[model samples]
Target: MDMQTINTFLSTTAIELLIKVGAAIIFWIVGRWLIGKVVTLMQAAMNRNQVDPTLTKYLGSIVAIALNITLVLGILGYFGIQTTSFAAMLAGAGVAIGAAWSGMLGNFAAGAFMLVLRPFKVGDFVSVGGITGTVTELGLFATTLLTPDNVYTLVGNGKVFGDTIQNYSHMPVRRVERTAQLAGSVDPLDAIVRLKAAIAQIPNVATSPAPEVNLLDFKLEGPVISVRPYTHTDHYWQVYFDTNEAIARVGKEAGWPAPASTQIHRVTQA
Candidate 1:
């Protein structure tokens, strides 16, 4: 009520606000420095361990965000703001958001599972959810794939995890299986033996497993000779192409008849 009392009250309030402000500024600076050091150390550890780049970056970002958030809340609390109440409100809001974005949360969960399980890693060619490509990046919500055509594709982790994942590059060796079609007149038993021998000549085909050739089925045109060749995954395409070419060459030399053409004759009603 008095002028002196009013002046004293105003001075005290201003001094307290200034002190809180100064302390907040100091805390922020110190906290950020410490956070930076911690993050740098973490990155160095990851690099030393030969961790995947994608995972390392993701982990660092998450850690940085969490630390920064803690710093902000600490600063806010220093200013006499009720951070506990704020956190409670945020938790409630997070629950609502989690429910609202259930699908996105599912993707996050799936990504976490994928990281833990290590089903496939970057640079591995995988088939999931009908999309086959090399995994370029694995994010928190989706997996980025570079298709054979060089097109970038994004598949949600939730869907990919739910579906089957076939990692063709998981192992060092890959088996190339092909069915060579032959004309009905061709004798498969003899040709199968010869073809297997010819396919074995390919240098890329591995010797440990040994090449195999057997008659798979009898179609309208001829017998289908199943060919299984083992080779290194990196040289898969070359082996596949060379094996296919060899099959044709061997089959032709063995007097295997060519496929008969299918002629569709549609006569209009007169």
Candidate 2:
């Protein structure tokens, strides 16, 4: 070919290439901005509607990912690429991915079950997956737990859903049990009465059922008084400690008499 023809060909090729790249760049930027706006708007709506936070976050991520994929395909189409065929190819790849990560997919399935079954929620104390803690975040694949000592644990949904789930915060009321010990020499009935009185005075202790104080087991040192108190779930720890303290104080006021039997010898016997 002659120089003139070659120059014309080069010029046309450069312009076409530049246009494709510029179009791709513009689409990429605009698409990203739109994704952000959509996610932000959806987040606000979810918060306003009181959607479960975990589900809301997971749904927003899925939407953003789907939109971004669409944007990429559109950009590819501008470059004379066959996105329809590409999508079919992706479906085949997806099957391979599912096969490779079957366990992960199982976790995903379990997570879906948790969402539908509603066994627990954020802030609920639960025991699952051989661990116990407060549910902090529920995700599509795993659940986050915050233990009593401030430790964070991530347990797979598959394991969590497969095992027994103990939700301590499920009930409105709970029982708190403690024991007050008195020397066996003291009258059991009197100790029981005073211990029950002390538990009743504690704030938030349930009154309808009343506190039950009974003579239970006997130890070498003293007689055991079982103190069972009822209270709201939220006040469980508070009531537990308060009732214990009360029992100790009441027993002390009556005197901590030594157990019935003891041995003593006189040095002057000889």
lDDT of 2 by residue, 1-270 (tens): 999988997799878899899989999999999999999899889889877677778779889999998999999999999899989988898899999999999998899778767899888988999988889988879999998788999999999999999988898667898877677588888888888788889999999688888989887666888999988866888999998789778868888675564446678855
lDDT of 1 at 89: 86
For model 1, how does the per-residue alpha-carbon lDDT over 47-144 read when each residue is reduced to its tens digit? 89877666677789889998998899888887778899888987899899999999999998898788867899888989987899989988879999
> In TM-score terms, which candidate is top?
1
Distance (Å) between predicted and true CA of 76, model 2?
Answer: 1.9
TM-score for candidate 2: 0.68
* Candidate 2, pairs of clashing residues: none
Q: In candidate 1, which residue ranges exceed 4 Å CA deviation?
A: 1-11, 43-50, 182-185, 218-223, 258-270
lDDT of 1: 0.87
Model 2 alpha-carbon drift over 4 Å, by segment: 11-14, 108-122, 136-140, 149-151, 178-192, 214-226, 241-270
TM-score of each: 0.79, 0.68
CA lDDT of each prediction against the hidden true structure: 0.87, 0.86
